[model samples]
Target: MNAIEVENLRKEFKSYSSRSGLVGAFRDLFTRNYKIIRAVNDISFTVKQGEMVGYIGENGAGKSTTIKMLTGILTPTSGKVIVNGMNPHKEREAFVRTIGVVFGQRSQLWWDIAVQESFRLLKKVYRVSDKDYNEHMNHVIETLDIGPLLDKPVRKLSLGQRMRCELAAALIHNPPLLFLDEPTIGLDVLVKLKIRQFLKEINEKYNTTILLTTHDISDIEALCERVIMLDEGKIIYDGSLQKLKETWGEGKQIQFTFVSEMSLDTLKELTDGLQVTWKQGEQANVWTAHAPSALLPEVISRVVNRYSIQDLNINEISTEEIIRNIYEEGVVHG
Candidate 1:
């Protein structure tokens, strides 16, 4: 079953022009003029059961707007959104009951209340049975490693600690679908790893369908099998991560460190047919080629014959770079 389905989902708002002066403001209050802003413009996609999908775009690219419509927070001006076979906007309560949402900038927990108390409140709101609530709480607490933080007030907890609690709270009802919006934002490396692991576990164990929106490419790489790229309120790219790389990321880098200094002119001449990107401390030079694997041996031989070799490293073009390039270069599909 498709966990979420959207067809031609478009949302628009009337942005009013505010007047600066008192007289203009008074006039505006009586005669308000506005322009139409299309926050989400006729975008469509479907997420099946047990699938992890990444929705990414720049600021004002309509990622959050799409998510809000899907979760039934904002009603779409046109088009359709069906979550678990129910129109989200019309059946808000039923739709919400089957899904969970976590926003990094927002907190559903009570500020002065302990984390445990917050979880208890969520349990009641979701109408989770005592037996199922305990089981789900134990599972999430163990997976997120937030047992130590349960007694701490949410206001006093660290960002990482609070994030773990938030995840635990979102999952206390054992919902089948989860929406995570920048769940790892402002987290340290260790905490980020922990949250990623927990997300993977939940998806695998429960076959929970997930739609994640994050600026962190690592989150997409580590979690999503499919990625939907949005730009200017449109779905620009929707496909596997590997296909995106193969289409746009065609170059790799070969970096070399020499034992002794070499003249820049001579080094440039030696490494012809490669784009020299950087040099380090008179000892290292980085070059880019269409295919590093095909050119590594020949490049190394020429560099070694001219200068003493120290260390060398070759790396494929990163996914983050590829996505950025696509956005800049504007990759369009029919």
Candidate 2:
């Protein structure tokens, strides 16, 4: 089953302006000057049931706009959105009950209320029965390790603590679809790991369909097998994560620190005719090279034979760098 189906989706906002003067102000009452800003252009995609897909883009790429339309917070100017077999905007009251949303910087909990109180309010709002509520609530508290925070006021919790509680609250009703926007933003390493693990387990155990949007590349790398990248309100790439890496990120970067400095020219002589590009690092003793992964053995062997290496490190081209390049170079696909 398809969890979400969007076709020719487009959203536009009007920007109106007028001259600053008494005459202009009077004229503005009768006449309007405005331009249409297309936040989300004609884009289409489908998310399968139980699939965890990453929706990623740079700022101003319309990620938030699309999400707003999906959750029924904003109406689309054109096209269609069907989530869980219903229109989000048309079937809002019933639609909201089937989905859960979590924003990293925005808290759904009441600030002055105790965490447990807030959860109780949500339980009543969602009409979750006592039997299922207790079963799920206990499971979430144990999984997130937020049992001790139940009595504390929302204002008293740290960012990590609040986020854990947020996840638990979102799951109180056991919604089938989950939307997470930067759920790991501003979180510590240990907290991020725990949240990622929790998400994975939930998806596996209950077949929850998740649509995750985040600027943190590590989160996407860890959680998503497929990614939909939007640029200028259009879908630039939508495919497997591994295929993306293999296609655009074919080389490995090797950083070497030698006991003695080696000029780029001399290093070129050592690895003569090999397709290695060497660049100097900020530190004089360190140098970095980019070469095909298949040629790494030859490149490293040649360098090791000539220099007394202090340290050597091999790293794949990061997803962050790859996405930046795509943005700058305007790489587009159909």
Candidate 3:
């Protein structure tokens, strides 16, 4: 079953044109001249149950607007959004009951309350039975390692601590769908890793569907199997992460450090066919071209014969570089 479905979804807001002066501001308020700013253009996609999907885009690209519509916090101007086979905006209460939302910059927990107290309040708000609530809370605390932080007031806890509590609070209701927006933003490396692991485990064990939005590519790389990329409020690409890599990620870099200070011009003369993408000093050089995989051994042999060998490294271009290239140089589909 599809956990979330959007079809030709469109949202627009009235944006007024005004000058910088007080007269212009007064005229704008009185005249009400405005233009339609389409925050979310006609875009469509479906996310199946138990799938971990990454929704990524740059700032002001309507990512938050889309999430708000899905969570029933905002209504779209046109088109349809169905969550768990129900219209989210129309069935706000029922829709909210089945999903949990976490925004990294915001807090759902009470500032003055202890972490455990907030959990108890959530238990009542969701009307969770004592037994089920205890079981779920125990499991979440154990998984997120928040047992040590349960008695501390939320305001007193550090960012990482508060983040773990936020995750625990969101999951306390045992919702089947989770919408996480930049959940690891500004977190330390160790805390980020722990959070990622916790999310992976929850998705695997509970079969929960997750739609994670973040600017951090590492988060998407570690968590999502499928990625939906948005640019200018439109769907640019949607596919398996590996396929995106294979399509845009071409060429590899080979770096070599010579044992002796051999002149770059001499090396270039010897390997003139190889595209020397970058050259630095007398000891290091990088090459990229349509060379066969077998050509590496032959090139190394020639280089060793001409100059003393020291160290060499060859690696494929990074995924970040590939995605950036795609965004900069738009993909042309045949």
- Top candidate when judged by lDDT against the true structure: 2
Write one digit per residue (lDDT tens) for candidate 1, span 1-334: 9999899999999998987799989999799878999999999899999999999998899999999988999999999888988998888787888998999999989999899999888888999999998877788898888888888899999999998888888888888999998888999999999999888998889998999999999999999979999999999999998888877776676666666555667776877776443344422343333344566677767777876766777788889977876777787752
lDDT of 3 by residue, 121-214 (tens): 9888888999998887788899889999999999999999999999999998899999999999999999999999999999998999999999
Model 3 segments more than 4 A misplaced? 20-26, 254-313, 332-334
Q: Candidate 3: what lDDT?
A: 0.84
Give the C-alpha miss distance for residue 89 in model 1, angstroms.
1.2
- Superior by lDDT: candidate 2 or candidate 3: 2
List per-prediction Cα lDDT, in the order shown.
Answer: 0.85, 0.93, 0.84
Each candidate's number of clashing pairs is: 0, 0, 0
- What candidate 2 gets wrong by more than 4 Å, as runs, is 18-32, 256-289, 294-312
| Candidates 1 and 2 compared by lDDT, better number | 2
Model 3 shows how many backbone clashes?
A: 0
Give the Å shift of residue 144 in candidate 3: 0.5
Indicate which candidate wins on TM-score: 2
Residue pairs whose backbone atoms clash in candidate 3: none
What would the TM-scores of all predictions be?
0.85, 0.86, 0.83
Give the per-residue Cα lDDT of candidate 1 at 239: 92
What is candidate 2's lDDT per residue for 70-155, written digit by digit as tens?
99999999999999999999999999999999988899999999999999999999999999999888989999999899999999
Output the lDDT of residue 16, model 1. Answer: 89
